[model samples]
Target: MIEVSKDGGLLTLTLNRPEKANALTAAMLADLEAALAGPPPAALILTGVGKVFSAGADLEEMQAGLGRNPAWERVSAAIAAMPCPTIAALNGTLAGGAMGLALACDMRLAVTGAKFFYPVMRLGFLPQPSDPARLAALIGPARAKMILLAGARIEAEEAQAWGLIERICAPEALMTNAQALMVDALAAKAGHIAAIKALIG
Candidate 1:
């Protein structure tokens, strides 16, 4: 459900079940949490192997209720708690809870074709803790409300304009740009990164 690898100081976690659009399960979330809990890295990248970063939680399990799946929220919170800079490599569309997870990242570098939306209102669920604040911080309160309240499906360009994404590159160029962005960020000492993350978080 999740694959993790490290190259130099960069740790990359790829959501494995691409056939299912990388929809998250409890096992997958636990895998993510366990990976995050280990020794800190200079930078961490969370992405999906194929199209669709994540389709959010599994709807079949969600039948039990949104509260039944708290692992996703825990994983999102863990990303924020990390001492290093975290990047959400948005290779594809992000929706529902997946958007919350991306919002938790310190930076989001997305492919220009990627789309995003938070359908909490349509789904009858509230945004996770820290999500509203994070979204508001990036795009401001009005646009945040427009997304959360209106269930707007935002395009990559619009999202970039709103400051929801740091940059939009061609799909093939996404990782290259992401790596370049993280190079300087990861150059800082771990202690300095931790202190700054604490301040921002």
Candidate 2:
């Protein structure tokens, strides 16, 4: 499930199914895709409410071929194209297809205990189309290959060191830190925000 909240210029999209480790379903992916379909906000924070940001696609749904769903690419592409600054506030371990969502964000902030891994090789599924390039851009080809091809589970410290995550914070400080990081973006005019992001790209 997806929980959407807006406070003026800031939009926060939270993955809310704690019972399932916030595993994504087709309907959940549809909700995510729809939520991000409109005009961009000044800033956006993508996170989850449980110990695991997401366990990737739901097992049952994956078996039913949801892994091949185009919605995954659509959601990630929408995030990638956002004019506003986007951050992935990773509350816990990030795995499977869900890695695409974080990879699309402009920056990633993870909790100290969070782990990063995409086990597509082990699971026998290719990651969404844009994920590999985005991932390689952030952490480089060999490291990206380590996760995608060899299934290495990177700890938060290592993730930060390797440029996978920008910062590592205590679980309690995650949201506050994310908000702090957005202060400048939220204060700026929408056009200014977009222009700055474009310049950085």
Candidate 3:
């Protein structure tokens, strides 16, 4: 579900189920919430192994839960509200609710080969509107509409050009650069970072 490793102040969380395109399960989401809530790691990096960052929720598991459960909301909110700086390393394509998870992060950096898409409407679903405010803030409302409402998939280069991604790197460089960025973040004054985040939020 998730592989968590800590080195100094950096916490790296990897989505482990590549066989399923890293689609998140309920148990996996629970573990993710617990990991985020248990401690205040100086910085957090969320990524995925193999190809896909995440394909979104495990539809089978989600259907089993009937989409009415409160636990998912609680866990998602906890991740969104984590105190430390959080980065999403889009190691590959991201879709559906996984895009929501990426949106929860404070910043995003995608691999050169990565792609971003929001296809909830294709599934006869609606995205969590609050989750995309970060995307709109990073890009703009008009572009956000093109991406979200139009269900358009954008390549990493275009995303970077649009200011949706902080950086774009080759596949092998994604985690390395993300770690470097986290190191830089951890070196900054924590109070100042918190203040800036608060002011911006």
Tens digits of per-residue lDDT for model 2, 52-109: 9999999999999999999999999999999999999999999999999999999999
Instruction: Pick the TM-score winner.
Output: 2
Q: Cα deviation of 68 in candidate 1 (Å)?
A: 3.9
Each prediction's whole-model lDDT (CA):
0.86, 0.93, 0.80
Candidate 2 at 72: error in angstroms?
0.3
Error of 3 at 181 (Å): 0.8
Ranking of all predicted structures according to TM-score, beginning with the best and ending with the worst = 2, 1, 3
22-110 per-residue lDDT for model 1 (tens digits): 98777788899999888989999988878789888777767876445677678888898878988999999998777877898889999
> Alpha-carbon error at 2 in model 1, in Å?
0.7
Off by over 4 Å in 3: 65-72
lDDT leaderboard ranking: 2, 1, 3
- Give me the runs in candidate 1 sitting further than 4 Å from their true place: 198-201
**Which one wins by TM-score: 1 or 3?**
1
Residue range 44-118, candidate 3, lDDT tens digits: 899999888998878898678624445556655766776678899998988877777787788888887888888
Q: What TM-score against the true fold does each predicted structure earn?
A: 0.93, 0.98, 0.89
* Candidate 2 structure, TM-score to reference: 0.98
